[model samples]
Structures are given as structure tokens and as C-alpha cells.
Target: MRYSASHKLETREKLLQSSAVSAKRSGFSTVGVDGLMKAIGLSGGAFYSHFSSKDELFASVVESELRQSLERLGAEQDRDKLERCLKQYLSMCHVEHPETGCALPALGAEIARSDIAIRQQAEHWICQLQESWAQVLESDSLAWAILSQCIGALVVARMLATTELQHKVLKSSYDEIGRQIAGPGA
Candidate 1:
């Protein structure tokens, strides 16, 4: 049966969203089209109707995840409350839920090894994040530095050996960076 264009688009979006979460949880390269399609209640063959190939779907998924992260950050735009938002982002909760967490820490390594289309999308997202952060921070360089530190800290924390170690990494990184951001000199 032929589905309407709108239905097809919606199904494609569902697939992309589901794939994004799965990819974040299980690394993009390791996820199969069949599994992603199954999660969205669609057949693997239908994937081609929405995307030319897995890479195309991957690119879309990257964009969707990036937009989600930006939206979350955007909600905390008020400069006075930026640190609170950052604290939440660098917390243990964020580290423990990669599937629903920030795309950078979840799939940064995989994205780095992906093709040009995926890499470009990732780069675009990073630029947007840097710009948004720059607007809130006193200095662009400081914003970039803070952004890097936060992402790096999250990635490292997520990679730790134990839950206690993960929490320690996150707490120490958060405290040190938070102090730096709050210091009179900053």
C-alpha cells in the first residue's frame, strides 16, 4: 500500500530519531539498518525510500541530535543561570544516559571517523554551539575553552572504570571548571 507523503516523512523522522538514540547508545558504525528500522516499526527495505543509504540516514541523525543538544542549551540562555545549566550537563546523570544525552560525548569518536557529510554536519553543530556559548560568555575564547572542557570532561567521565570513578571524574572536573568560570579573573 502506498502511504501519503506526509506519512512517509513522519516515518522517516521517527526512524532518524530512533536511530539517533540507538547510535548514541551503540556507536553509529555498529548499528545496523535492520535494527534501526525494527526499532521504529518499519521494515529494513523501507529505509531506502527515506534515505539514499545508511550514511544519509546517519547524517540526518547527527543533525537531529545536534539540534536537540542546541535546544537544550538554548533553554538556558539567561546568562545568570548558565552555570547551573552547565552543572547539569556535566553531572553523572548526563554521563549515565548516553542514548538520551549529548551527541558529542556519546559519539564524538565515531563522528570523527565518518565520511565528509557526517563530519560536516558535526562541524556545523560545533560551530553553532560555540557561537551560542560565545554570546553568553564574557569572551569568545573563554566560551570555546569552557565548551571544550565540558565535552572532554563528560567523555572522560563516561569512560571511567566504575560508577564511583565516573562520579569523581565528573565532580572534580565540574568543580575545577566551575571555579574557573566563576573566578573574578574570568
Candidate 2:
């Protein structure tokens, strides 16, 4: 059966989206190509039609997830809008829902361990996100700091066993970032 180009593209999109959610929810390496394909109602053999290898699929997932994160978290130019984004990002809802939230907190460890090519792809989107904040804040260091804080806070929050501690982790980070953004005098 020969599928049209658009149909192939749609299948690929479904595969990517399903793979990303699975990866974020349960480390990318844990799931095989068969599992990824199974999630999208296709056989494992069809995987090759969309990607050359599992690594290639992973790279695509990384790019897709991070680009989406960039659009959600980095599109703001004003301080108020950025702060609002941060608040939502640092909430318990985000911590409780790794499958649908930003990829950084969910997949940072895997991304750090991936090949140089994957790391570079992650860096491209991450740097673009930082630049958006940098332009708004007028300080590259601050942008980087806040970015790290947000991801780290989420990671730590999710690690804790109790929701109380998780909320503390998130609230503290949110407070500190707000203070930093307000500057020394404020």
C-alpha cells in the first residue's frame, strides 16, 4: 500500500508526538522503536519509513519538544509576561504532569547523556529561549540563571516524595527568581 506524502507526514507527526510524550513520561531510552510505533497504531517495521533510526527519531523529538517549549516560555518581551510564564512553569501542576509539560525538567538527564549531535540540537533551542529573555532583561547572565533555576527547581520538586516539599521547592525558586528580576533595589 503506497501512502501519499501528506499521509506519511501525518503519520510521522503522530509518531513524533506520541514518542515525545512517552519519552518525557518514561526516559527516552527505556522505550523501544516497537513501543513507539505501537503507541501510534503502527507496526514496528513502519518506523523506518519515517526515520532512519531510533536515534534519529529521538533527535527529532528533542527538537520538536524544545522548540515548543521555546514558543511557550520565550515568546514574551516584557517583564510581566515573562514573569507570568515563569509562574505557570514553576507550578505544581507542571511538576505533576511531566508528560505534557516542558521537556527540560522531564528529559534533561537523558539529553545531557545523549550524543553531541543531540546536545547541540537541544542547545540551539535552549540558547534561543535564553536570548529571548536576555533581550527583555538586558542581561545574558540573568537570563541563563533564571532558565537554569526554572529547570532545576522543577527537577528538584518532582524528586521529592511529598507534595509539601515539592511546593516549597517551587515556591522558593519562584520567589528567588522574582527577587532577582526585581533587582537589588526593588
List the candidates' TM-scores in order: 0.92, 0.98
Best of the candidates, lDDT: 2
lDDT of 2 by residue, 12-89 (tens): 999999999999899899999999999999999999999999999999999999999998988766999999999999
Over the stretch 93-163, how does candidate 1's per-residue lDDT look in tens digits? 89888888889888888888898878998888888877887787756887788888889989988788798
Clashing residue pairs in candidate 1, if any?
none
**For candidate 2, what's the RMSD?**
0.8
lDDT of 1: 0.83
Name the regions of candidate 2 deviating beyond 4 angstroms.
Answer: none
Alpha-carbon local distance difference test for all models: 0.83, 0.95
Best by TM-score: 2
